[model samples]
Target: MEVGEMEMRMSTLSGEQGKEKETQSDEDRGYDENMSDSPRESVDSTNETPSKKTQLEDGSHSLSVIKKAVVVLTRLPEYKVSTLRPPTPQQFYSEDESHSSSDSDMQWEPEDNSSDSDFSVTDSKQKTGKPTQNDTKKTPAPQTMSEPAPIIISSAFAYCANEITKVRPDLPEEEVKVGMMVLARKRHMRWQQGKIVEIITRKDGRLKYKVNFVEKGKSLVSGHHIAFDNTPKLEQLYVGARVVVKCQDDKFQSAILAELPTRKNRLRFLVFLDNHVPVYVGLPLLHLVCRPLENSLDDIRDSPHKCFMSRYLRDWPYPHLTQYSAGQSLNAELNGVQQRCEVQEVDSSLIHVVFQDNQHKEWIHRGSIRLEHMTRFLELKEIEDYLDDSD
Candidate 1:
């Protein structure tokens, strides 16, 4: 019995050992499968993590590049960037385009309230701001143009009219018609014969006449300077008188009146010079030298008239005849024509003169020259035209 019991115990022990070995093999197989699966899972997890990290880095780099592009666009000028940019809301749009945009905005309003509110505020601010800026730019231009234009125009007209009046105070204001002959005082204060060309009436109702002066150019003259006739009227005063008459050469010569003036002869007197040269003269040309008694005409005719004239001529108050000097400027008679001359040499009764008009030189009697005071007066009057502006 003991031997059988020992065998059985030994078999049971062996069986227990075999079962334990089987359990170990199963556990080992499971562990080996787990190890293989774990390796594949770990590989997949590592790949996925690295891929996610790379994707995030690529997204961040693209964002940085896009930001740099926006910065570069912002730094460019408006005109250069205009082609690259879309139309802005504040820019001017056609009526149809604005209506369409408004409809689209209305359609999108409920879906995008915050964006719509911001856009509306910006549009309102832009609309209000633009007009004020335009007003500031436009207001000054009209004011600058309108304020001083009339004042300057009126002042200029007044100044010109005043200057004309001051220069020709001797002129008589007369009603004149176009195509009429009149004596007009020139700007140089010289009387000239002119025919009225046109009559200009200003907006202020003032009249200015255009004159075509004889031998001079045309000029605009005021009414004050126009005279239909400027000749002095001759009357029956002192016939048969000895007189000094300004001849055609502008020299004063002694003459004895032979006949009184008559309307048929245009108020001219018949006179005989000391050389017995007969001529007709206007009243203005004659200065009374001496009016002899009515009964002395026969005695004066019988006596030598040349000798009587020479006696009076010697006592004539002509101071400039003795005051001749070299380089003196005077008006003289050359070949019976009045001319401007400069004295080259002087003698007691004769002077060497160089004509200003033709540079011709000649010796002439001192009696042929005009008075010095008349030339000086004319020069001073011309100078007064410029000096009046200072006052």
Candidate 2:
């Protein structure tokens, strides 16, 4: 319901930053801690070694030695039992090469050692001071995201009342997430009213939407493309109509269909001030009314942006007047009297006209000059009558 200023621009959310925010909100607290506890404990227990076990190169160890190690490890404080030893760079590279070589062999083998024996071997392995290879491979930190792209828009005039609205400025793009109501103009079509269902990216690098709206229990619209306009103010938008879309000065050029993706759809229209900078527009009437002398109502209604444009160009009961050109030479005729005038000047109002009657005389006001009488009466007026009266 808020009206946008003429300078507003529409933008949208996209890319990794947007995805991350959505993911963070869906994550459950405590879930990570609960899942990691058991795994941490198992890893710690396996790393424990007994002092009695003699470490060997063949990877074998005695059962009694492992049992003694477990008992001793259990008696120790939890903090002392496990030491976090991260691998050195040289050892990490060596292990990585070894694993890579072994993986290519594609042969699976079962261990002949008992669980107790394996535990002692692991303990002895820990005593040797070698660390896990994973400790060396650090994950790269996440990078900061860049800003979203700006919305592009164009301008056109309204052709009809179906696109008109009293709503004024439309909403902002920040407020227009997926699932908000919007107004759009279809390419080569009338302005349509609809709500957004999803925002999607196209192969052509423009962001578009899957919109949903109903007309009399039937779906009126679905996935549609949108473009921008420069005429309407940012906040006010044409609501509930489809429009023919025009991109360049040539109407023959191809263009995408468009609507407000959300209530916040802001666009730029081309304003011929100095250079072509972006200007915002809302509703069709405001565009026409603001520069009525330069723009016409029919031109707007028929424009590609008309669905939204039409919404502003509402019909009125009264007829408006505009000046029309008249040819040179005022043939003077005054109230059934005719005469030739040497020089003339004239002034006109809605109800009357005043002009010099010729003979280098002063001007006179003609009462109630009707459209039908203008030409005929001009043929029969006297300039001398005004001059004689003045004398």
Candidate 3:
């Protein structure tokens, strides 16, 4: 029992020693803190004791005000603050900065008469370090294309008065002028060259022209069947006139003008051949005689209608192709990409289509969409039944 009491007394002594050591360490920390504050206190005493400092010393400063000052807090390691110092005296009057003052930093003093005092703060972009719009380079204006020269002919020129014009299929009336020359196409005959002497417009905008065909005589016809005469550049393209036409490989070959340019085709000519049978060629394969001499023979054939059908369909856009009507389903180009569309309307300049993707209607130009090139692979009644089946 005596040995157990001695062991308890030893434990009590060790506990007392630990308590003494902790108290000694706390006193030492207080002493070190006082030592660190000594220099600051001396400096504060040397300077004028400001109202803020005196309020802090008295512990009368509010928590919000103390938090905002943050002079001691900024010196902490958490903020990584090294310097909170003001600019040095030498930095304000540096030799290099004083000698080379930039326009951006130019300041006017009361002693300076060179600069005005009414400085603007609105355009101080340099001070704020923001970009200015004036620094960007301006884009140059686009160059315009030159206008086409006017098509003029002397009044003495006889054939220039009534030139041919093509009747646009989209419009009800042919927009033909009184003096414009148009090709008067008959049922199975060669397209007779005619000049519009007078145009009589009906109430519904249908044009009836008194066409004076130089050979077939004067006849009043609707402008629907007439086409503009854009024949090959020839001096005088008569049906039986002997002409030296430009052939393949830039060689001039002898030929006769069979027919002038139609809407479907250009000028067609009967080219003479030495060995093979004479074949009719168009303007691209043959140019009209630029200069013909006195001995120009008048070439004519009894079988002129034999090869006229073959030559006419050579450059036809809808050859073996089906014509598309309204409510017809077809794939067509929308913008630039081809998509499925239903034909809503067809006009000379534009074709209205309803796109399947967006169910939106858009007008496509006649030049872009090939509505004429559809071939009839199946029966027309079968196609109608197929469309019904799809529905």
Which candidate's TM-score is highest? 3
* Per-residue lDDT of model 2, residues 1-391, tens digit only: 2224311311121343355445644443333434532213333345443333333233463323443223111233456545544556776467544443211111111122112111111111122232336532332222431221111111222223423232333354334347565544433333344566676677886555655643422132323323222234434433322222332342211121122322222332212111111122223422211111122223332332333233223311111111222222332345445443322433321112233454344332121122212222221222323554789
| Candidate No. with top lDDT | 1
lDDT ranking from best to worst?
A: 1, 3, 2
Model 3 lDDT per residue over 110-129, tens place: 11212222111122222423
Cα RMSD (Å) between model 2 and the true structure? 41.4
Name the runs in model 2 displaced over 4 angstroms. Answer: 1-175, 216-322, 325-391
Model 1 lDDT per residue over 1-391, tens place: 9779857866775676577658756755764655522112112222111101111132344211111111111134456556666777757654333432211101100112122221111122123212333333332333223221100000011122221121112333244688877656465324456788999999998788888988688888766445443333333234445455667775455556544543323455656565445567777776542222333233233244444333323322211122357886766655556677888986433467799999998665343323232223223333554576677
lDDT of each: 0.45, 0.30, 0.40
In terms of TM-score, which candidate is stronger, 2 or 3?
3
Per-candidate TM-score against the hidden true structure: 0.20, 0.18, 0.21
Candidate 1 matches the true fold with a TM-score of 0.20
